[model samples]
Target: MKKKFLMVFIVIVVVMTFFTPSYAKNTVEFPEEDSTELQYQDMIMLFLGSHIDQAISDHYSFYLKKDPIVYPYQIEVKKVKRINEFREFHFVIILEVTPVVGPHITVGKDKLIFEVSPTIPGKVKLLKFEHLETHELPPVWMHLLKKKPSL
Candidate 1:
């Protein structure tokens, strides 16, 4: 009886261990600790990979006076660069404007490119554009683009 009980106990332990979730250890210190490089790469990937559309919208709002009522182009990041590992990067993105221009008229088709980097602790800014260019672009254009339009 003892041998049978012992065998079953061992089997149960082994099965439970196998079924246990093996999560990644949180040993990785903040990327900012050693070099802002990792953090920069992560930030770039997070921003570009996750928020390229928002970035574009931000650019338009910051530079132009209107936001596109339609998301015509399939925007993608072509290349990402990390400068000196201190959390700065140059992200090259490609926007392919589809022929369909919905509620908004298509302004002359032009590839929009801008240099963006971290300005605040966790916020990104367009390094080239300024805040108070009154006749240039409306600030709402910036806010509108950054947020995904409700489908």
Candidate 2:
């Protein structure tokens, strides 16, 4: 009877483990309304969370593959400043981003220049994006993008 009970318990545990919902490790979190820079950072994080692997491969790989293998990456929002606010304004987002490799590679200092319109009824567009100078990346991150390039 004891052996039979143990077998049934093990089976139940296995079934529950297989049926449980697995949550993704990374998520995009943003405030409802904040500085333009914060909003831009949130948008970028959302974009990456959706297409992280593909984006990494497109930027780093030579061979094309259906699903590009990628590693865990993160971004630090260094600063957000508003230049001008009219119908639309240009805001600066200084960010530090890490890249991925067979083993995650730390890509050093990075920044993105964004043109954003204040929130509207339904949608927000990333009007323009440009890479900025890579300053000293923390030892954990390896810096790339030597100079600002229009994207």
lDDT of each: 0.40, 0.44
Give the lowest summed-lDDT range of ten residues in model 2: 63-72
The residue-level lDDT of candidate 2 at 13 comes to 100
Best-matching candidate per lDDT: 2
Clashes of each: 9, 5
Tens-digit lDDT track of model 1 for 8-118:
999999999999764323222333354575455445455543344454455455334454332322332234445456655634333332111223333222233345555
> Which digits, one per residue and each the tens of the lDDT, describe model 2 over residues 7-57?
999999999999976432232343576788666656766644434433444
The TM-score of candidate 2 is 0.33
| C-alpha RMSD between model 1 and the true structure | 17.6
